[model samples]
Target: MLYPATKVTLIAEHFLVERVCALIEACGGHGYTLTPVGGKGLHHLHATSDRATLVEGFDHQQVEVITTDRAKAERIAERALKELFTNHSGVVYLESIEVCRRERF
Candidate 1:
């Protein structure tokens, strides 16, 4: 059997990773994932030719958390947006998913 859960995804600036992960933990999230990513958007671009030259603060980054508690998921997103996104560019959203080994969430 599987249980329904909310998958919270946050795509934010590189520098705010510490804040985002801390918020997830403080909000009762058991586990989360962080990946260092870069791409071309209206935001800063990581040049393909020279990987090391990618802009520091303006590049792409992602943070995600999965939990059965909707309120906790929402709180993590809310805190990140309110504290981090007003002065920077980022987006946070949630998706519904069925997770196995439900207690792990």
Candidate 2:
């Protein structure tokens, strides 16, 4: 059987993984999937010349949480943006989805 749900996705600096995971759990997300990801965006192009060194590639993480409650999903996304994304390079988005195994979420 398919169950309706919401998927919240957060992509941010690798160092923020722990905090992000904690936030997810605190916001009623029972579980999540984490993966190391790499990409180039405005943050890369705007690197300041003052920095003596530059670290590139795979410096970001992708955190995904699927839950049956849309409010819980929105809460996760909103909190992440307000509490975490300010002054940080990150993005949070939510999508409607269907899960085959509802209990797993």
Candidate 3:
């Protein structure tokens, strides 16, 4: 049987990664995957298709959390948005997903 769940993804500057992870755990997220990522966003100083023209050293991190329910997922996203994104460069969103082994999550 498939178990319903929510995937919360947060992409933010590397500096705020630890704080965000702490918030996720506090909000009942069992675990998450953190990865180094790079991209251009609406707030970017230069949003261009030319990869070569992209600025250097603008490090970012992608945090993904799969929760057993939507409530927990929303809680995490909302807290991050209100507390962290006020003066930070980041994005948080949610996606509905199914897990084969719910216990693992």
**lDDT agreement with native, every candidate:** 0.78, 0.84, 0.84
**Model 3 stretches astray by more than 4 angstroms:** 42-50, 53-58
Q: Write the per-residue lDDT of candidate 3 for residues 1-105, one digit (tens) a residue.
A: 899988999998887899999999898789999887777772354457866544554478899999887888899999999998877878888999899889877
In model 2, which regions exceed 4 Å deviation? 42-56
Report the Cα lDDT for residue 77, model 2: 92
Question: Which pairs of residues collide in model 2?
Answer: none
Per-structure clash totals for the candidates: 0, 0, 0
CA shift at 20, candidate 1, in angstroms?
A: 0.5
